[model samples]
Target: MAKSNQTKSKEETGASRGRKGDRADEIVTAAFEEFTVKGYAGTRLEDVAARAKVSKGLPYLYFKTKEELFKAVVRSVLTPAFDEMRDLMLASDLPSEDFLKGPFLAFLQDLVKSRRMLIARLLISEGHKHPELTRFYYDHVVSKGIAALRAFIDRGVERGELKPTGLHDFPQLLVAPALMAVIWRSLFEAHAHLDTDEFLKTHINLVADAITTGNRGHETS
Candidate 1:
């Protein structure tokens, strides 16, 4: 009977975890919809609960606060993207130019396919008002991105694949154009349609030109 009880307990534990995982996913998905529509400053936890169809207290059970929920939403959207990027960084036995033209390019391409782009637009729109959210975003997303870029740039410089530039120290510059493109797409795409693929190609060309020691052909395609 003791052995049978242990088996029951193990089954219950696994089932509980499965339910929690489902609830967490529902909460994050609901939070994303609300946060995108209302922005961080304007969204309410109550609304997230409603959209999730969970009890009013269920969100609190999963996330301590709205900011934490927002972070979870960002994480759910970004973890896969950055996981791919981090893995790419790890396997980067390539030149800086090729790195940019390859894995970095792949990340940018994936960016357009995910909800991280929406989260990014929220960060731009409400980040000043919610400094904590901005800080969290930078601490998790921006900092990792910059660190990866810095390492790549450093390696490029050491191997003479790239010219010595300020970007080696401040790799944040590499992400600026991508952010600008996201912002433009969020705000003005409806007003004046812009070709995102062309924009990304030009941006990559400009960055590659700035970093490459010799004349390089633009091949973002």
Candidate 2:
């Protein structure tokens, strides 16, 4: 009887933790929607709780404040996907041109399609006003992304696949078009429908052409 009770207690605790995790995920998803639509300054915990279909006070139980919740939203949504991409960039033996044209390009396209882009736009427009958000985003997303891309570029140069030019020192240049796409889609899509797929593909090819030694003939002296 004692052994059976102990097993039952362990199962109950596990189930309780699972339910808490599920609730947290629901809250985070709802928070993402709210933040995307409302912006950080405009979003409220009560609104997020309502969107999550939970009591107003419940969000505070999980997150002490809106800033903390916003951080949680990024951590849950964007960080894991980016970390996977970074890890792939670090580990893959694929040539830099192929990697950029293939997996890296695909990742950027998918990012434009996801809520991550919405939040990214939000960060750009509002992050300056909120130092915490700016710092968190930089520390968690921007710095790591730049480092990973730099490493990837360095590897490409070492492999003789990419020219040892100033471009290798500035990986952000490669991704600038993606950020422009995100902003344009949000601000001008109705006026001018951006062909995101075609645009990103073209951007990837341009980067590949600019960096890859095989295309050096295309460059001017």
Candidate 3:
């Protein structure tokens, strides 16, 4: 009888934890929406709680400050996707061009489809004022991504698959178009439609051609 009672207690505890976890996710999702619509300085924890439809003190129970909440939003919305891309780059032995055209292109599409661009806009517009937040993002996310791209580029060059260019030192060249797409979508999409899919495909082909030795202007099929 005691063993059965203990088993029931453990099951109840697990369910309690699951409920709390779901509530935390709800708060994070609400926070992301608030931050997207209102810049960081304009957003308040009370407003986040209201948006979350939770008690006024509930957000405080989860995140002590606005900064913590903002970081949580970043982790929830951005970190996992970047982590997946980094892992994919690390594990794949495919040709550099193939990797860029396939997995990297997929990642850029996912980035555009998600709320990540709004987060990027936030970082670009307000990062100087919030040095701590900027550093946190760079240290936790940007640096890791850049390092992964650099490793892949270096490996390709060493194996004679890529040209002996400066790309290994500056991997930003690989994803520059995605950033451009963010800016264009934010500022110019109302005036003119930008076909993002074709844009990215062209970018991938151009980059593949540039990095592939003696393969200038060759289109990727």
Candidate 4:
């Protein structure tokens, strides 16, 4: 009977995990839609539940509050991008101007495709009201991204492929254009009539040109 009880407990554990997974998926999906359309401040748990077709109370089983749900959505979107950038940085045998360009280009493409611009705008708009949520985003997403970029730029400088800019400025050089691109596409493009891909390609070229050393006989303007 003890052995049978152990087997039953294991089955129950498996069942609980499956239920938790399902619930988490539901909440995330719901949060994505609601947050995408309404912004974080405008979204409600009931709206998420309605969108997910789950009981309103069910979201609490996965996330304690709407802020937590929003953070989860942001994490779900940005974590993979960070990991990809980290991997690209790691796999480079030598740091060169073009070496950094590939991962940044790929990341920019993915960022544009993901409509994360809308999510970012929402975060910026609502972040002031929910300082904790904004702080969490900084701690988890932006700070880590800046650190990663700084490391890559430092590597390039050490390899003599890039100029010896201060590390503090290195992240700004690498990240500012990408941030500007997102803002332009999401916020100003309607008025500015900008083509995002074209803008991204041009921006990438400009950044690559700026970072590469002339001694390497690489083209720089």
Q: Output the number of the lDDT-best candidate.
A: 2
CA displacement after TM-score superposition, residue 25 of candidate 1 (Å):
1.9
For residues 1-221, could you state the per-residue lDDT of candidate 3 as single tens digits? 99999999999999999989988899999999998899898889889889889988999988999999999988988899899999999888677777888988988977875677799888888888999999989888899999998998887777677888888788888888888888888889999999887898898888888787643232335
Instruction: For residues 130-201, write the lDDT of model 1, one tens digit per residue.
Output: 899889888887888777778777777777778888987778777776777787788888899877666776
* Model 4 Cα lDDT, one tens digit per residue, 6-85: 99999999999998898888789779888989888789998999898899898887789988888888788667667777
The TM-score values for the models, in the order shown, are 0.89, 0.93, 0.91, 0.86
RMSD of each: 3.7, 4.2, 3.5, 3.7
Give the Cα lDDT of each candidate. 0.81, 0.89, 0.86, 0.75
Candidates sorted by lDDT, best first: 2, 3, 1, 4
Which has the greatest TM-score?
2
lDDT comparing candidate 2 with the true structure: 0.89
Clash number for candidate 3 = 0
What TM-score does structure 3 among the candidates reach?
A: 0.91
Clashes of 4: 0
Better candidate by lDDT, 3 or 4: 3
User: In candidate 1, residue 42 scores what lDDT?
Assistant: 85
Q: Sorted on TM-score, highest at the top, how do the candidates line up?
A: 2, 3, 1, 4
